[model samples]
Target: MLKRIGYTAGGFVLIGVLAVAILWGLSVGTVQFSLSQIFNIVMDQFSSPLAIDDPLNGPEQTIIWLLRMPRLLMAAIIGAGLAVSGVIMQAIVKNPLADPYILGISSGASLGATVAILFGIGVMFGENFVGIMAFIGAMAISFGVLFISNLGGRPNSVKLILGGLALSAVCSSFSSFVVYLADDKEGIQTITYWLMGSFAGAKWDMLPFIAVVVLVSIIFFWSQSRILNMMLLGDEVAITLGRDLHTYRQVYLIISSLIIGFVVYAAGMIGFVGLLIPHLVRMTIGTNHWTLIPFSALGGSIFLVIADGLCRCIIPHAELPIGILISLIGAPTFVYMLVRKNYGFGGE
Candidate 1:
């Protein structure tokens, strides 16, 4: 028990260090900021400037405040959203190989974004339309998977995966079809970037909505961690405890889908945090979602912030897509965990 507390405390410190590192990453970019300038921006508010009209400003302030800060904040949200959702999904399915994206949420959201961008289906919503469509698309895929799997019988993980795969394939094919037919070069380019994933589109306006949704969902799931642990025990054992999980399972899926919808809208499907962070937490803390959920959320934010920072600094004048950077580092880390620990979602 004491050891568990140590791990939790250690986890918090680790998160802090990562947060600082990410801020440093935000500062040292194409237009670098000295520690003092960075400090000033952090301290300054609507009240007054950090210094008495410090001349050492302008583009640096604009770059830090307007560009990098929002991007990094979005990364934190996406990372935490994906990781927490991944933890929830893995728990629900009792599968070690589960991630929010693995169940086709990302693909579904992508398809929705593509349709809106290409056909302007939800353009009536104006600037917010694209995100609204993506949310609808995520819910669509989730329901499709649930409906298909339940038609035959209980949705064991196998049926769930297969259902997600079929729906994802259909969505991807349709998106491709639309792109193929569209003559607009600009539309095609928009789809391409949307597919790759980014925080470059991050705006203060959108971040608040995303933050509230993600934070609220995290709190909601954190309360259910005890039940989540039962999920890993499989349906048979769960029934023995007088709690059949079919209803709760669906509840988690829908809630996580909402979170994923927001993340996909904000970041365009930054992968790895969902897949990698939970695995790491499970490796360190075991399958207990009580600890896993919050820990994974913090870890995911740190991971993404650092990754985004790398994206900014890696190329002198340009940025790498956060999605690709996550894959580059996260995939190998996952492989190593799978090979070494061979942990089986705490089931085996």
Candidate 2:
């Protein structure tokens, strides 16, 4: 117990240090704001409704609030949502490698967004309709994966994985066909960018819905830590322990699909944080989700905030696509982890 507590504390502190680094990066961006100015903007946000203020507090306030702040928030929320869904999907399927993006939810969502943009569908919901359709597409893929795997018998972890890969290929091909057919130069450009992902679209209107969904799911999953721990032990073992993980796994996949749907709608296809962060947390905190889930969620949020900050400041006038950044970093790290083989979040 003491060891678990210690690991959790260490993870939280490490993440806190990373958070400070992220804030420093934000204040040091191309549009520089002094640390004091950044502090003042944060204080002002709490003290008043409008950022409408004195001229001396001008560009600093704008830089801190208008640009960097929303991006940071989106990064954090998307990170938490991905990590949380990763935890749930891993528990549900009893696989160390399961991630929403890997399991085809993201591909399905990309297809939905492409359809919405090209065909002029879902217009009534205005700007948000694309996200809604993406959510629908994601859930459809999730069920498709589940049902297809269950065709012969109860889905083992291997079968679930196989199903996800096949469905993901189908979705990707369909999306590619749509892009090919459109032949609209701007539309193709938009689709290409969306596939790479960005938090540059962050806005105040977008915050509440995603935040609440992520937070509520985090709380819900935190309470199920024991069940998740059992899930990792495999199906027969879980059954012996008197839990029917079949229904439970389905429930978790559905909930994760909902979260992933919303996240994909908002953030596009930022990948690997889900796969990488949980394993990193598990390496430090062990497989116990009680500590692991919450810490992983916090760690993920911190990671993305820092990553998003890096994406913003790395160039003078342009932003790096976050999906590319995560893949670039995550792939090397994943290879290192696989080669090292000492950390052991169940990878063989």
**What's the TM-score of each model vs. the native?**
0.92, 0.92
- Cα miss at 179, model 1 (Å)? 1.7
Model 1 residue-pair collision total: 0
Candidates in order: C-alpha RMSD to true structure: 3.0, 2.4
Task: Give per-residue lDDT, candidate 2, residue 93.
Answer: 66
Give the clash count for each candidate.
0, 0
Question: Which candidate has the highest lDDT of all?
Answer: 1
TM-score between model 1 and native? 0.92
> For model 2, how does the per-residue alpha-carbon lDDT over 34-95 read when each residue is reduced to its tens digit?
77877877898779746445455567667778677777888888898898888887777666
